[model samples]
Target: MAESEAILAAWDAYSDRHSDADGWPLDEVAYGWRMVQRDSETWRAFLPVRPGARQLLATAAFQLQHLSAGDIAPHWPSHLRDLNQALDRLEELRRGHAEVREARRTSGPVSQEKFIDSVAERNEEAWGYLDTWAAKGHVLLDVHAAAYKAPVRWVPTPAPTTVPARRAGRHV
Candidate 1:
């Protein structure tokens, strides 16, 4: 099956299992994963430009941190640590890109080519970190869905229907 189909199937299974209890936010998780997949494909086509790539990286970091702060962290400390490491590397790449941009701005048009050349390496490094983070996130989501469980609340019983007595046993 295609990757997206597999992901959808897994989500369906997880939702079925956790139908009674609150768990991960499905919309947020799905959106984040979609962004990661799109970014990876774009990276393969060509180096992602700075603004869009930064946004994607920031989104990934936020999602990772959200997962880490939730019930998943305790159950998967190693995966959480890997995500944190990836975040650090991504941040470093961001700083490097910013510095290059600043240098280019101050150097005027003459050095534009030089700056672009320098940024290519940093962009590639950013893509590498992002790819690793995406893979780790997939594993984290799968494991969390498989193992994590929130507090179970029993389904409330329905109230009894109040039926009026037949009118003095009169026939309908």
Candidate 2:
């Protein structure tokens, strides 16, 4: 299996093994914010940032402890241990992947694994950061929608008619 596929499967299996009652699943906001899947309410993946301070994610880093850095980490006592472990394992896997290694070798000047000095590479990095930021709730705005359907009733606003400037003293 591809490295990415393996990573994905590993994450899915790990997440599936956890539950709310068991204090698993970690932070709902810290998981996936780039995917809505078949359920929207379950995870606000594609929604705008909601109102509230995003305690866990203001930035992204390789290390979980460094994820928030100076900022106080959110209160996720029950799941912190597991989350840290998962991040560590994921990091290890990525570091050890042949593709990742090759990508790193291909990266130029300043060093980056996936982000080479190219438009597409930069775009991918930006998207990756956006996804990470969204997951961490480090967003300035977020909007929620119900099924994202067209309006049931269409009522376009009427256009304003141009009113000619009033003539002074009955001047045509």
Per-candidate TM equals 0.42, 0.20
* Candidate 1 lDDT over residue span 4-83, tens digit each: 33444554575655444565544666644554445444344333333354454355444545443444445355655675
Q: Across residues 82-142, which tens digit of lDDT does each residue of candidate 2 receive?
A: 3334334434433445454465567644355244324233223333433333343321121
Q: How accurate is candidate 1 locally (lDDT)?
A: 0.54
Per-prediction count of colliding residue pairs?
0, 4
How good is model 2 by TM-score? 0.20
Check candidate 1 and list the clashing pairs: none
Clashing pairs in 2: 48-142, 48-143, 49-141, 49-142
* Local accuracy by lDDT, each model: 0.54, 0.36
Best of the candidates, lDDT: 1
Angstrom error at residue 75, model 2: 9.5
